[model samples]
Every structure is written in C-alpha cells, then in structure tokens.
Target: MTEIAPIAKPDRNRPEPLWHQAEQALRGLIADGTWTDGMQIPNEERLSTMLGVSRITIRHALRNIEDSGLLRREHGRGTFVRSSTVIAGVRGLTSFTQEMAGLGLIVGSRILERDEQAASAEVASALEIRQGEPVVRLRRLRMGNDAPIGVQTAYMPLARVPGFLALEPSASLYQTLSAHFGIAPREAREVYRVGTVAAEDAALLGIETGSPAFVVERITSDAIGPFEFVHSIMRGDRYEIRSRLHI
Candidate 1:
C-alpha cells in the first residue's frame, strides 16, 4: 500500500504560532478521514519532522488535541485518534463541567440568562416548591473545547441558594452550591428523551433549527428537600449516552 501524505502541512515561515499550526494540521487529518479512529499516529519525533516543527511543538499540539477528546495517548503505545463523537455517561448526578473534564475535554459556559424569577407551574412542580416562589434561573450555553455542546437551564429555590446569582458566569454550579451554599445532592432523578431543539436552543447550541437533540430533565434533592431542577438540550451529532451495565 502507498503511504498517505498529510493533507495539511504546517508552514514554518508563517507568523502564526507554530504549535497551533501543527494542531490544525493534525486536527485536519482526523477531520478529513486521513487519520481514522483508533489509528495510532506517528511518534512525536516523526510528527515533528513531518510538521516541520520541534518535538516539543508536536507534543503541545498533541496535548491540545487530546484535551479536546479527539485523541488518547498511552505511554508505551503511541497516541491514537479517539472517536469524534463524545461519550457522556449518565450513571451519576454529575455536573457538565465534571463530565467533560472526565472525558479530557475543556468545558466553558456563556451565561445566557441569570436572574431571579417567580417559579412557574412546571418549575414549581419539579422543585416541589410553591408556585410564585422566588427562584434563581440560570441558563447557559455549554461548550467543550470552544464548540457548542448543549444548552442548559437550571432552577434553584432562592431560599436554598441565596446569593448564587452573584457568582461568576462560568462558575460550576455544583461546586458553587456545595462550597458556598453548603448544599449537595443526596439523590437525583434524571429523565432522558430524544427530541428536536427549537430555534432558540438550536442557535445557542450552534445547530440548525429543529435538529435532533437529547432533552434531559433532572431534579436534584438534598437531605432536606429538592433544591435544583435542570433541563438540558444536547446536540445529537456529537453526544452519546453511555453507561456500563452491571450483572
């Protein structure tokens, strides 16, 4: 079989950062189907030569790609391309940030809505709070490696989490709740369903209107009572629900 030339070649003379260029080239290989899933890529030394960069540069590029969940590295075995689709396990009451971090993907959030509102009937019912009770509504566009992954809207009773709205926009909800408010979920129930996202959610998730998506509804309760209710819309193309079954 003939050797396949890399589709993207890093330009040494270009003013752009060399490691970033190398990363783009490597990512291009995977995106274009030249380097397939589970295929072990060249060694750092060989990649350095092919990309016209130093071993350190190649290493940095590989690390970035790996952090995006597109590659996995073994010490004895070489680095290999992971599947482009991200596997999000639903086995626990895990936060979005924690889940992405577990998969080696960088998590980011852009707060789309953060304000106190009287609980609607649906929200009241989910959180087991009285209707018209004040609650904190936090809606965010969740991203993994700067790519849109999901849109999440969470509601928490103001009595349980006072001053939560003052936190930073990108702060992890669970961490802040546990650290500042002394709240933790003792038990949680999550419902997952396949549905199409509306135009607003689709735009936030960077997908087309009415795209296939996963609608996840969750109610997290502490020892005292239910404290949080969350609804999330996850992109179907890039996300998969995974769990390890026990006998």
Candidate 2:
C-alpha cells in the first residue's frame, strides 16, 4: 500500500473560489493515487480541518466530486472513492504504474519471475538485439485495489540495464530505467489482440480458463533504438483503451 498524501490547504487570496480550490486539491489526491478505489475518505469535518476550510466548502467540493462519478456518498456512511476502470490512451506510451495512477488506482505487482535468460527469437527481434543474447526478464501479476488485473512479462537487454535484477519490481520499471540507466522510451509500437486467456494467465489474473482477454505486445524504443519488449495479458473485463479521434 502507498502512503496517502495530505491535502494542501487552499489559499483564500487566490481569485478562484475556495470551494473550487478545495475541490481541485481533493481531485489531485485522487489523480495521484493517494485516494484509491473503494477507500472511504475523511468526513467533511475532518476534510475541512485538513484543508483548512470550513465544512460548507468541503461539502460543496465533495458534492461536486460525487456528481462527477469520482466518489460515492452513502446515507449514514462516509464518502468513498469510486472503483474506476483501468483506462489507457491508445496513443500514449505509458507505463502501467503511470496509467493506473492517472485513474486513481494504486497498482501492485506480484513478481512471478525474475531472472537473466537468453533472449528468445521473437524478443530479440522486437528489441533489436541478437538472438541468444542475455536478457533480463521480469514477469509480474498486476493488481489494482488488491484485485488481479493482468499479467505482464517484460524483457530488456541485460547489457543495457545491468543490476536491474536487484531492484524491487514493485516500483515502476520505466522510472527505474530512466533514473538509474538513463534510458527512457521515446516511442512505442503496440499490437493488441483479442483472444481467450490461457490457463496460466487466467490463474494469475484470477479468471477462468479461456476467458476473454486482450493480449498486447509492445516494442519500445529509446533514443538509441528499441530496448524493451513486453507482453501483457489484461483481463478483458477490467481494462479499457480510449483514444480521441482527429477529425
């Protein structure tokens, strides 16, 4: 579980309404994954204290957020963050961590496999590395709100990301790569297939065998060239891809 960040106090001096600033501060918590799915939030009074605002302002902000489908208010109960869909933009090159965080979902990973292995022909082709070259492989069971969402296996050239095996897979791989290895993906090509989940992936994702799934293969390139190849099997019921069309 991630630490929840404290809500920032709204500035009364700003031209924006106090309720609006309070609303944006609360929304910022949701957007950054601090206020996660299905989690009950502080009461209006508590929120008022935290944000240094009156209960009335907090109430107005909470009502606006609830009306927008970001929260649910139950009678005699507290407001809870809504369990939102795991959505990704079709045109974006985003890591699973960033994608989930944007939707206020805390992403968790159960490491299934982590080892150095010889690159398979397909992986080598995708990464533009020689076949049989050493590669670092990390396989993870991806989770949201403690529910299984997908199984992702990523491969990178061992030479490019040395000592990657030592880092915890719970953190974002792309962030680690950029911070430690100075490698960042600039472009990505993804191929999505609608298919039935295999027994292995189904077991990891807590779904029945032959359940519908989206099989995605992605080849990502840094400044030098292709460096990462990833395969993901996402539960069809839990994931969605959105893209805005250009007219």
Q: Estimate each model's TM-score.
A: 0.68, 0.68
Candidate 2 lDDT tens digits, 13-74: 99999999999999888777688777889888888889999999999999878755568778
How many clashing residue pairs appear in each of the predictions shown? 0, 0
lDDT of each: 0.82, 0.84
Clashes of 1: 0
Residue 35's C-alpha lDDT in candidate 2?
82
**CA-only RMSD, every prediction:** 9.2, 6.9
Q: Ten consecutive residues with minimal summed lDDT in candidate 2?
A: 82-91
Query: By TM-score, who's the top model here?
Result: 2
Which pairs clash in model 1?
none
